[model samples]
Target: MTALAAEAVRHDRELVARHAYGDPEAFDEVYARFSGLVFQIARRMSGDDALAEDLSQEIFLRIFRHLRGYQGRSSLKTWVYRVAINCCRSRLARRSRRERAFVAVEEGRLERVPSAAEGPQGRLRRREAAETVGRALNRLPLAFREAVVLRDVCGLSYEEIATVAGVRLGTVRSRIARGRDRLRLELERGSS
Candidate 1:
């Protein structure tokens, strides 16, 4: 490994050690740092806020279960992301089997208590765009969608993504490239 990569691995080892052996507070600190990232991955992958929240909570539960024994062969983020992705995949598969297939809730179709952070109009537009992109994303095959989310939205390095995906570096590159192209086409077509 490169020096930088080695340093990252060392850091993750130390952090995991701290969480495993230190006071309970150390685990809380780890949770605080990773929860948002976990939530983001869940939300983007599942395209459902409520489901994403549930998944995030479930992810944390799993993390706490396994964090104590992390082997440190990969960075902590990659390991957590792998867990998040696996959770999402299982949830999606179960949902699909339960129903014929999953369907996205239409944009602004969700009833919300109004918030002043942005006017209702602004929120609507943003929601619509998000819905459009999400619908487009959902149309992608899971492999392509995951590669896109992991690299583009979640911002993992190609090497990290390979570790998470259990694929080679070249495969990660191809998936990301193909995913981006598919996304572009979907956006232009405006229907999935």
Candidate 2:
């Protein structure tokens, strides 16, 4: 690691230690630093604003409860990411099962009528494009989705993703490639 990178890892270790030792502000600092990241990951993985908010709360609670047990093997960021991803995956599994048993009333949505405030066609096109991509992302398999989200959305390096996912570095690269290819295909199919 470069000197600056090493220093960052060391700082994260110290932060975890401080939190474990009951430094009252340590966790608040952590929350301030990572809350946005956690929410972004939750929002992308779950594809719902309200569910993302709830998942973010659960992730913070888990971090608080398990902070003392943190091993300091990885940076605190990677550890928190793994925790968040695991929680979201588990919750999604439960939700999938429950949803399979019932038909959702909100499954179909009405088309929006352009109002005076939505004046520009370009802006409306961008919104539609983003929604299409979001739907394609939601269709990805769990492993691919996680890999893509960590790398593409959360912007983690391949090495960091390997560490977080407990997989080999090559596996991370391969998953990312395949995930991206699948995502592109999904997007193309949607456009068709």
Candidate 3:
């Protein structure tokens, strides 16, 4: 790690320790630092804003509840991400508990509405495109899906993805690449 990266990790470790000790300010700072990332992960992975909000709340609750058990083996960011992804996985499993009797599905929603500029046909085209891409993403394997979402949707670095996924850097790279390739195949198959 660079000097600044090392310092930030050290600072985050302290913050996590302080929170474990019931320091309210430390908890607040940690929340402030990571809530956005947590929320975005939940939101993107779950595909429902309302559900994402609830998932975000659950992620924070789990974080606070398990603060004392944190060993700092990974950075606070990585730990938090692990929790967020697990929560999302659970929520998704429960939500789609049928055909997917026992599997993880992080099917994200395309919740964008084209502006007034899109008119009618354009809006239809946009919706179809979003659904097509969303389905392709959803078809990825769980490992690939999580890696791609963290790297592409959450904008996390490959190193961060590796830490969060508890995998090696090369694994992260392979997962993302394979996920994109699978997504491309799915989309092409759908369009045909």
Candidate 4:
């Protein structure tokens, strides 16, 4: 096996052992491993970096608190993702009721773009496309957005996604199909 793959397997075993033994350090390892995944899901769902950071922290806190209750029905990673998604959903619901604007950037002069190893023009186009996609994702309905983010961005299988979203497998598949179709239409419209 590849070195990275071997390392991942070792880490997974270590985490399970530590968690099962109630080792706090083992929980910290779990947090370090999955924190980025949590943050990205939170950021995508909330469309606000600050909110995402807060939600990521909250998810980790919940995971630490509930680690003992985890029954190992699903993978530990999937359980953590479920917690993150639920936390993001709760924050979204609260923010929707309050009608808060989730601006991604502050009002100021344009920031310097990253140095483009692919060339300036290609980089500009790529950046514009990314921004458009981000906006389109943010415009989607919360359920659809979460489906796409978990499936596409996080690369979760339909079964894993179903577990994370607390939905049936069929529902997860339908939502992902519809979400991709909607996003395609939005992108086509924007391009045209």
Segments of candidate 1 deviating more than 4 angstroms: 1-8, 99-131
Where does candidate 3 stray beyond 4 Å? Answer: 99-136, 190-192
Summed over model 2, clashes come to 0
lDDT for each residue of candidate 2 in 91-182, tens digit (9 for 90 to 100)? 88787667643324433332332333555686776677666667667666678888999998888999888888888999889889999998
lDDT of each: 0.79, 0.81, 0.77, 0.78
In terms of lDDT, model 2 sits at 0.81
Global Cα RMSD, each model: 5.9, 4.5, 5.2, 5.9
Lowest summed lDDT window (length 10), candidate 1: 107-116
How does residue 29 of candidate 1 score in lDDT? 76
| Model 4 TM-score, all chains together | 0.77
Question: Lowest summed-lDDT stretch of 10 residues in model 3?
Answer: 102-111
TM-score, per-candidate, Cα-based: 0.76, 0.81, 0.73, 0.77
Q: Which lDDT tens digits does candidate 1 get at residues 1-192?
A: 899989988977887888778668767877888989999999888777998999999999899888888998777888899999988888877874565433443322332322325565977867766666666776667788889999888888998899888899999999999998987765655432
> What is the lDDT, from 0 to 100, of the residue 59 in candidate 3?
93
Q: After superposition, how far is residue 120 of candidate 3 from its true place, in Å?
A: 16
lDDT at 7, model 2: 92
The lDDT-based order of candidates, best leading, equals 2, 1, 4, 3
- Rank the candidate models, highest TM-score first: 2, 4, 1, 3
lDDT tens per residue, model 3, 53-140: 9999999999889877778677778889999888877777767556363333333332333333566687777776666565456555
